[model samples]
Target chain A: MQQTRTVELGTGLFVFLGVVALFFLTTQTTGFSGFMGGDAYRVTARFDNIGGLTTRAPVTMAGVTIGRVEAIEFDPERLNARVTMRIDGRYDQIPDDSEASILTAGLLGGQYIGLGAGGSFDNLRDGDEIYLTQSAIVLENLISRFLFQQSQEDQDD
Target chain B: MSVLRELGESFVSFLRILGDMALFLLRLVMYTPRGLLRFRLVVHQVHNTGALSLVIIMISGLFVGMVLALQGFDLLARFNSEDALGTAAALALIKELGPVVTALLFAGRAGTALASEIGLMKATEQLSAMEMMAVDPMRRVVLPRFLGGVIAMPLLVAIFTAIGIFGAWLVGVVMMGVDAGSFWSQMQANVSGDEIFEGVFKSVVFGIAASLIAVYEGYRAWPTAEGVGRATTRTVVLTAVSVLILDYMITAALL
Candidate 1:
């Protein structure tokens, strides 16, 4: 009986430890905490090319992440990529005229949306679209353009 | 003609075994409520499987994490983007390595133990003795062991992942001098709830597979020493193959 009790006690401790680890993974390691606790507002932007921008990528202002890209959809009417962003409620003062651009993190890192603040009094509200948007820079396009410019320069020389 | 007949007979035997396993699983499920009522028995098995396996799981997790950090930092540093080490290591551990490795270890450690123990009981006629005494061995013995493995598996996976992340942090930030703030912050910013759910879901599925294979092999072992040994070996092999196949299927479905 005593041995059984000891075994049971050990099992209880093991189980408790496992639960704590699970809680840590969910709350700290993942974005589950932010998803559950924060209130956020949605805004839309359109780009000709989003590059490798994925859902759940960070939306940053001045290098600080302020929200997340909730969804990316194709605008059939405009023939562009429409991105929906969910900004944290605390950052509600983003100007209506701000520019949204898809930017890469470092050379090989994932793509994210960077919002540049505009000098307007009006703040962006839910469902409002940011009109000034820059598409992601395609590497192949840049390389080809560079080569084309080089050829022109050689011809002129 | 003899060789062709042998091949056909083997195939038929494989089908029969699969059918038998399915029925055994159904019976285990039916007796689960009764097994729950004997919760103490289940607890004992949990102690056997979970607590006993903790040291090995933790050590393996730590070493795996440390190795990931070392490899990740080396690769990321060449690009001058070592700050992404935390995100890379955490994603690899959480999404793939943690659950899969834990299930593999659990099968090797606990699965073989369950199979051999049950096989020995059959060899000694203890299971038959219980049957003659009017106690259902399925409910009394097998269900508790199966439930224990199923319950203990996810917990072990969780612990393994947590320990692995800590090991990565130790190697990345402490020893390698990676920026601590970026390491954690980047991981937090990048990893989503859905990815974590995928890991937990995989662990649960693997737990069921590992435990089921162990108990089924043990319960149906031929009542002899060589039979018990073969059953134990088969438990490990089958569980490993099923876990890997299931991991691929689950990842494909989720992704």
Candidate 2:
């Protein structure tokens, strides 16, 4: 009985240690976490449809996440998703006219707010709101639109 | 010609049947009472699954980490980027290999034990005896094992990652004479929090799958001794397959 108990305890310890090692191994593979809160600058963008947007989602400028989505909300009257973002503070000073479009990081990735720099001289300050926002291109809508256009083009041809 | 069409129809029918089964499973998961909150059962299962898996998890992780270091060093040496060996090993262990291999080890060990124990119980009419005694077998057996597996898998995954990374570090920094500072510093930059979360998520699911299959096969075991053997065999195969399937689906979406 004692031997069984001892063996069990030893096994439990081994499992515990192994899992800790696994996490350590993974964190080293993908180099993303820096000084968590210190890396990015914050801003807000609003959209009619956020779709799969969630907090902690990437806020990319020119396809690089200078920040992340901090919060998401829907206004009752407007029915639009109001997204707050924290961008890398150093990458700040985009002119107020910069456009934010929702984009997929990949085929399986959730939506992220992508910023396009504009030609305006005036730059966006911290706590500033980005007004020119484009929502996610809904996949179902795009598929239907493609099929309909294909049939139309066929008829025309 | 008619036979070909009939075969095609049958194939589609089979696929639709599988889809229906999947939907039922989804509903079953959805409707499962929050009975997973029994802390003692959870504790007991954790002790069982985790304890049973410790030595194998540790040794496997260690060797995998070492082998990764060796292979990574060999490959990266060609690129003169041998410095990235630590980071590469870390990522593979954390994201893909660690949980998967550990769960695979578990699919052979604790998973087999669980199936046999439950299978034997069924063969001996012990499970039926419990049912007659007004004992909720699912609550008493399945829930504990399932919860334990889910919790323990992640914990073991964490252990594997830590040890594996350290093993890589040892091989790279000490044995191979790679600079310790660069090896570790690069790791800090390359390994992201989100990746860790993804790894953890995968392992947890793997654990759940292993536990569920073990219990399911065991519980469904027939009264014969052969049934017990069949249950054990099925448990391992199903658990391993489930781990691979779950890994693919989760990683595909997460990435």
Q: Which candidate achieves the best TM-score against the true structure?
A: 1
State the lDDT of candidate 1 residue by residue for B138-224, as single tens digits: 888899999999999999999999999999999999999999999998888778888889999999999989999999999999999
Clashes of 1: 0
Question: Across residues A1-157, which tens digit of lDDT does each residue of candidate 1 receive?
Answer: 8998899898998899899999999889875475525778999999999999999888999988888899999989989999999988889999999999999987767899999999999999989999999999999999999999999999999
Q: All models: lDDT?
A: 0.93, 0.76
Indicate the TM-score of model 2.
Answer: 0.65
Flag regions of model 1 displaced more than 4 Å. A36-38, B1-4
Leading candidate by DockQ: 1
The worst-scoring run of ten residues by lDDT in candidate 2 chain B lies at B23-32
Q: For model 2, what is the error of residue B119's alpha carbon versus the real structure, in angstroms, after optimal superposition?
A: 0.6
Give me the displacement of residue B166 in model 2, in angstroms: 1.5
lDDT of 2 by residue, A53-149 (tens): 8777777787765776889988898777888887776876788889999887545335778899989999887788899989899989899999999
Q: Residue A6's C-alpha lDDT in candidate 1?
A: 94
lDDT string, candidate 2, B1-255, tens digits: 999999999999869845754553454365345646556556667777887677777778788888899888888888777777767887798889988998888888788888888888888887788899998776676666766776787787787777777788778888998878767765654567777888888887888778777877787777689998998998888778878888999999998
Q: Report how closely model 1 matches the true complex, as a DockQ value.
A: 0.78
